[model samples]
Target: MTQLPLLEQAILVLAALTLLASFSMLAQSRLTSAIHSFAWQGVMVAAATALVAAVGHAHHLYLSALLTFSLKGLLIPWMLHRLVRRLNMEREVENIAHPALVVLAGALLVILAYWIALPIERLELASTRNIIAISLAIVLLGLWLMIARRQVVTQVLGFMSMENGLFLAAVASTRGMPLVVELGIAFDVLVAAVLFGVFFFHIHESIESLDTGKLTRLTEEEPA
Candidate 1:
């Protein structure tokens, strides 16, 4: 069997690294560490995109790489760190479920992705089926993270993970999306993050915690 090219291998490896870091985030007990892992994952994705762009001569992918590096890698992580500090949420990263269970769920997601990808093995693309499956797993795991956590910050991280998965899928299917589309996505994400940061502060000020249950309680108590 002919092997995947070096560029293809690099892309697949980096995608795997991103997925692994996301799973690690599910199990990490400290907010700072989860933030660091997320940053590293972003850098890995950016590097992979750059590698693919270089190998395949996709000029627009360079912009995608830049977007990943600047937005996901640097800006978002820094903002999250500052947001945590400002909101005094720089403590433990609690999981509503057991850490062992969380890890198991992530593993199942990966297995499911690979299993589903097995049916589409005929296409001669660079990691097409595997990457798509992994991307879907990433999206589902991110949703799981949101459901299995009480903290607003963790839910925000889950949303970011979903976005990462979408980007990964785009890369796998098309090598890269257009620069304008990537830019638009970046803009929307930035705006959403800023809005959420403000909302975080408000939630903290009102309840002295970043838990979603507290917000639900607030909603329940309000007069209809």
Candidate 2:
């Protein structure tokens, strides 16, 4: 068996850490802790992108890594922290309906992701194929997070995490998207964050709660 290069090994390690971070975010009950986990996941993804850039000699990916670190790693998390404080949800703990069961479901999703990626892996298109599986797992896990969690803020975290997964997949599979595309994505995400912050305030003002379940109840009652 041919040995993987040292940089590729490091990239794989970082990819695994990124997946672990996704799991951490899923299992986290506290809103702040989950956001922190998400930030670290972004950092790991950035590191992996940088390593991929180094391995593939794709200079554009280096810029992608910087953009990811700036937007996903630092700016988004900082914005979320401020939102949590402003919304007075800094100490809020979301109780997962069945924590163990949800974790088991997440594990199943990971396995399924690997299974789905097997054919692509056979092609041996790139050293990052395994990371593609991991990226799919991250995406599935993010979707699962959105389904399992009830808090609007947590759901938003899941949504952003899904974006991270997509970004990682692009880097792993194709070395990175065009600079213009990445910039567009970053801008859209920032606007979404700001809009979500506004939505949180509106929800809080309307019902004094951030639980999404309440939104359903809201529609049932006719406005006065």
Candidate 3:
């Protein structure tokens, strides 16, 4: 087997960490552990970005690393923790299905993503192409988490995870996108989170729980 260079090795290690984080997200039933898993994923992403920047001598990637560490790694997860606490819904998270099944489904998604990304090799650097597979898999897993679960809160968390995967894909493929673009995405995600926060209260009041089945009541009317 050919020896991997330091940069490639670093990226691979980070990719593995990301995969683990996704699994952790899938496995976690409660809000606090899920938030922690997401934070760890952000940390790994920042470390990977820093290592890549050092190896490639791309100063912009260093800035990207710092931004990721602050926003996703710290701020957003912290906000999620506080939000859950304020809602008094910390230990009350309800998964629509068993966690073991969810995790198995996520594993299948990773395999599918690898197969799906195989043809995209024509578009990116060799290392980037492989990383893209892992990135897309994470995104898919996030989406699955959103769909498989009933709680709007968990769905929002899944959306955030999806954005994280998108960020990883951008960095892996392009060594980080333009600063303006990155900032735009960050702003958009922040706005989305706030919107979800508002929605959480609304959902709670209307349905008494954020569960999807309960949300169907929003469309039904009590006949007078």
Candidate 4:
């Protein structure tokens, strides 16, 4: 740690915090708190990307950092908050069959990610190599969150978190993609949030709840 430059150390701290935020989200029950954690993760990611730019001398990464901060950190979070308010689902608690087991699984995922990224880390010379495993762990955790939860909003949060992990991986490994590609991804996320909002309204109207498990009842056969 002492051998690395100060900027790299700072980025590592932010990256670690980002990973912690992912775990926090995985453990949180309230919808609003999960959204807050997701926003914090976005901020950490933006800060890390900006620091990466400083360390790597990639000025273009600055643009991506700004976009990520504005889109992921600010706009998307605000959108989710509004959706929660509109649906009156802000206080809804996620249903996890086994919280302790879920947390344990997430930890195991981190260990697995480290093992899988070991070869790639060996081949890479960037300071970000150390964090690649963490990024992959976050991605897997998000996927696991989606599968464990029954609520649509929670599933959406998982989806966004997975994308966050992908962005973090790109920034860490390559100092971010081209400005055009990042811009497209940012726009796509915004659009997806909008579409999710629409779906929420339709789902509520049809079933009076956002529980995806309720959808299964619609397919059951009726007596003749």
Clashes of each: 0, 0, 0, 0
Candidate 1 colliding pairs: none
Candidate 3 accuracy as lDDT: 0.83
> In TM-score terms, which candidate is top?
2
TM-score of each: 0.91, 0.95, 0.91, 0.94
CA lDDT, every prediction? 0.82, 0.92, 0.83, 0.89
Name the runs in model 4 displaced over 4 angstroms.
Answer: 219-224
Report the alpha-carbon TM-score of model 2 versus the true structure.
0.95
Model 1: per-residue Cα lDDT over 33-121, one tens digit each? 88888888788878877877887788888888988999989999899999998766787666555778878988998888778766655
Candidate 3 residue pairs in backbone clash: none
For model 2, residues 40-109, the per-residue Cα lDDT tens digits are 9999999999999999999998998998999999999999999999988999999789899998899999
Better of 2 and 4 by TM-score: 2
Candidate RMSDs in order: 3.1, 2.6, 2.7, 2.4
Error of 3 at 200 (Å): 1.0
Best by lDDT: 2
Least accurate stretch of 10 residues (summed lDDT) in model 3? 215-224
Output the lDDT of residue 199, model 1: 92
Backbone clash pairs in model 2 (N, Cα, C under 3 Å; residues 3+ apart or in different chains), count: 0
Ranking by TM-score: 2, 4, 3, 1
